[model samples]
Target: MIYQKTELGQRAMKDRHAVEITRAQRSALILLDGQRSTASVLDATLSLGVSREDIDRLAELGLIATMPGSASADMPRGDAQLTDFASSTLAARHGPMDLPVAPNNEEERVRRYKKAYPLATQITATLGLRGFKLNLAVESAQGFDGLIELLPKIRAAVGDERVQPLRDALEGR
Candidate 1:
């Protein structure tokens, strides 16, 4: 069956806030450009160890869809609705929106840095190897503002769902 990115998936692709997905899933997602057959995409992703399940998960996440009438007999079209993408890739969890001015006081800055830093690391850490660079970025962040600047990148990497924790910490939650 041929699969293509859904509107939700398209938005995820266009936006910088890419949801955090397994490397396999991300690879599959990139290959599922509508014209490609499921088997072809799968074949291409074999190097990445992507399987039908990973593709299915992308479908489940609503990042990709089987073209209308493209359903093959082997894979039953069940009642299951596609899931939104990971890490809004299908749903990027933007930690709070449009960041405001950073706390001016050193104490408050330090406090926020302490609070948000771990959350940021935790988020990037979920990506495993793909996240190593971003994890380092989180580590190099100097203070609250530096960490805050990284929020958008974080949101792009993991999507908004995972960003909630970082967002909460930034908001002093």
Candidate 2:
């Protein structure tokens, strides 16, 4: 079976390992869908923070697996819809209801930040009714931008009746 790391799985692994992992190791393990070889895994580990000895030890301990050459008929087919649904649900429930950190790459960063903004706004509006205040630092443009970006979504999420007070506050009315 191909193993792809879920966010929860990654958190569990990190908590269990408790050791710092190299970026390369993280990338390799994430991409391992049961097809990459030991050498590739090793390279990935090396790229991350792990030594050869550690990689060997992990493999020996059955933490990492080497894919066999033959494909198994019993393996589940890739379920894109399921994956998307699960990811969205997880993100909504567990992910920070705020702009994510700048992504590793420009395109991805923009995409994720854009996607997270509206969701965050919606969540924040729900919280605002309970008197949760937003914290935006003077030195952080991104923080301010995120707050401003979320205003419209928050308004929309709150709807006309519940959002008037918020709008009054924002407009100093």
Candidate 3:
């Protein structure tokens, strides 16, 4: 999922509000625009020492939120009947602005997987046990075939009761 700064984040940026934070968190705050995906944010801030932990922390603090992937992400931003909150807010505050252009779908998916690799590795490290070496396989796997090979093992590790849900998530169902 993509992440973006909340109104609180906007306020923080304008110095209208103050939130005690680390240098890394502050750097991350600068990069947390509505347009960038989580992977993009992570990549941009890697050298600044902002990690997923910081993202999670900011999320917990209500300073940021997950932007939907694919199209229609903005629908839930405001009331159910209104998907215009983002643009409306911008227009109200700063006057007219052009609508955002959506990125090409395949390219966005590739970017997502590239970012997901490290997170997958982290999960494997957390859960891979006994002779199950998902971390190594996840690190080495190149594409769909590699992911397919690992699915059963992940299912096995997580167990029958949990496997279907896990599979659905992995497949983006």
Give all TM-scores, in the order shown.
0.45, 0.24, 0.38
Regarding lDDT, does 1 or 3 come out ahead?
A: 1
Model 1 segments more than 4 A misplaced:
1-96
TM-score of 1: 0.45
lDDT of 1 at 37: 83
Q: What would you estimate as the lDDT of candidate 2?
A: 0.40
Report the lDDT tens digits of candidate 2 across residue range 64-166.
6545543433222243233222222223434422322333565654554455444444445354323133212111226334544444434433444554443
What are the lDDT scores of the predictions, listed in order?
Answer: 0.69, 0.40, 0.55
TM-score winner: 1
lDDT of 3 at 114: 60
Superposed on all Cα atoms, the candidates' RMSDs to the truth, in angstroms, are 12.1, 14.5, 17.3
lDDT (10s digit) by residue, model 1, range 55-145: 8888888898888888663232332232322212222223225664576688877887798888888888887776666688788888888
User: In each prediction, how many residue pairs overlap at the backbone (N, C-alpha, C within less than 3 A)?
Assistant: 18, 2, 0
lDDT of 2 at 158: 41
Error of 2 at 88 (Å): 42
